[model samples]
Target: MSHVTARVSEGERDRAVELVQQAYADGLLAPAELERRLERALTAVSAHELEPVVADLPDQVVHIASTGGRVTRTGDWHVPRRLRIDSEYGRVRLDLSRAHVPYSRIDIELRLAYGGGTIILPAGASANADGMRTEWGKVICKAPGRQSPGRLHVQVTGELPYGRLTIRRK
Candidate 1:
């Protein structure tokens, strides 16, 4: 009998790397351990291979629900592995300039219905919005470049049915 293996995408690999970085940042992994995990994550070919890289780290999820009011996240806040934002007739702003982003990559899911939001990343951070969808609305992305070594990666996925989503570098 043959077992099929699921292939991992670039985004998955990037997220794995991010997890390793987060562990390192949190002092849970030594330099050698971090290096090893990073190497493994970058070379991982399947989802199963990425699991061990972050198995020892803590997992966190942030949820923001807005109703006709401004919701902002900024200043020394801890960046979670997953962030879910739901907005209706309001705005959301995420500023990562001085925030502590332990993960090298962060996944943000947004559901914008008649609302808008903005994501402000640090200088070396990169964002991928290919997985996001906008209908009857607009998404403006202004960044310096793509992800590279020693840079953070943000993967934006979700739907914007009737609002705007802006991602910029600060």
Candidate 2:
């Protein structure tokens, strides 16, 4: 049998409904459309029924994981509402200076074992790294600790062991 005909668990149904709700919250779905999708998602029995509910919505979370080597994202890339980067041993360079960020606030969660992370924020932006914990490293924030009103705010969180996280603005 095809995946579309496979049975869907309750968790899958809940995820579909949540995706529709988030799409509405993100202004991608109208009230009537969201209601329609939610109803369909709640009633969905198989993967086929739920597949189209949020097929066009942007992903709520983007996760990048690596075992080693360099992991970088720069230039005009779409910055998601939430980002997760996990690496065992690699340098992470996320340059948001020339990126296309639609949201006012972006949350970045990083978990590194033995690699350093460098995040270059766009101008007129600030960051808060208070929630980050370093077991044997440091977290540096060159940008203002508190984000200003009407400006972009980057909230950094997660853990870094044996490596540092440097947040700066260009």
Candidate 3:
């Protein structure tokens, strides 16, 4: 339980590389350090190696659960392959229109109660909320449902009792 030795996927490697490059571009890393970290990130075999490469960088958000608070993500944020959200109240807004989406397909699992959620996808990104279930709420997907070649597909699943989930394309 102390270490994770699982083999890294190309997606993971690419994400790390992007983070490193971003750090350099943001002037958080010097040229020599950027080159060093980029090389290590590209050759990383597991999450262990990736830890050091991005240890000083901004942490990515993949999971969020709140009892009662508003949740929002906009601008140039990084989108992981999968996202999990649990909220008891307040609104959850996620705008991926200008974010860094490195995956072709993204999965989102939501658990909300007595609140609403909105997700805005980038242009040409297709998404579907078919897998979701609601007891006293509604799910509206304004984007296309089917997966398209060379386009991003988002699959959303979960339960949002007494809340609404709105997914639309920008």
Candidate 4:
């Protein structure tokens, strides 16, 4: 019999170990398989796994600095992963595209004004915001989501009725 010490709470650890024993007694797992599964379960139940899950999530509605990670929403109309700012000849356009990020969860903030605009996102794979105004156009953005354990695609676009257009992502 080997002893395993995991940083999980006592009850959780005991429960996982019990499950392993049950698996073994049922002949569903070999000794080595039981040990491996126990270790994996203990890690899965550890508190440390919860920290980075929210580390890159934004806490407010306004963006200050860029977090430079990435965000993947499982749905649509999401806040963008990159803050986009465009200024030319006194006209500006802000595009917020947080769609198609790779992570399971994220938080971000963005605002567009002086013709600027902001988007509150839910989750999706892409985004676009464009409008026509007389004097000024604005574009605002939020921090990116974390790219820790997956791949994400982000595409941003800015176009004018008679001037220029840009497409970008990192």
| TM-score (all chains, Cα) for each model | 0.75, 0.69, 0.64, 0.22
Per lDDT, the best of the predicted structures is: 2
Q: What lDDT score belongs to each candidate, Candidate 1 first?
A: 0.84, 0.87, 0.85, 0.38
Of candidates 4 and 2, the better by TM-score = 2
lDDT of 3 by residue, 61-132 (tens): 489988899988999998886798999988889899999987677778888888889999889889989889
Superposed model 2: Cα runs more than 4 Å off = 1-59
Arrange candidates by TM-score, descending: 1, 2, 3, 4
Rank the candidate models, highest lDDT first. Answer: 2, 3, 1, 4
What's the C-alpha lDDT at position 109 in model 4?
24
Cα deviation at 124, candidate 1, in Å, is: 4.0
Native-vs-model 1 lDDT?
0.84
What is the lDDT, from 0 to 100, of the residue 42 in candidate 1? 84
After superposition, the stretches of candidate 3 with alpha carbons farther than 4 Å from their true spots are: 1-61
In candidate 3, position 52 carries an lDDT of: 86
Residue 23 lDDT, candidate 2, scale 0-100: 80
lDDT of 3: 0.85
Candidate 3: pairs in clash: none
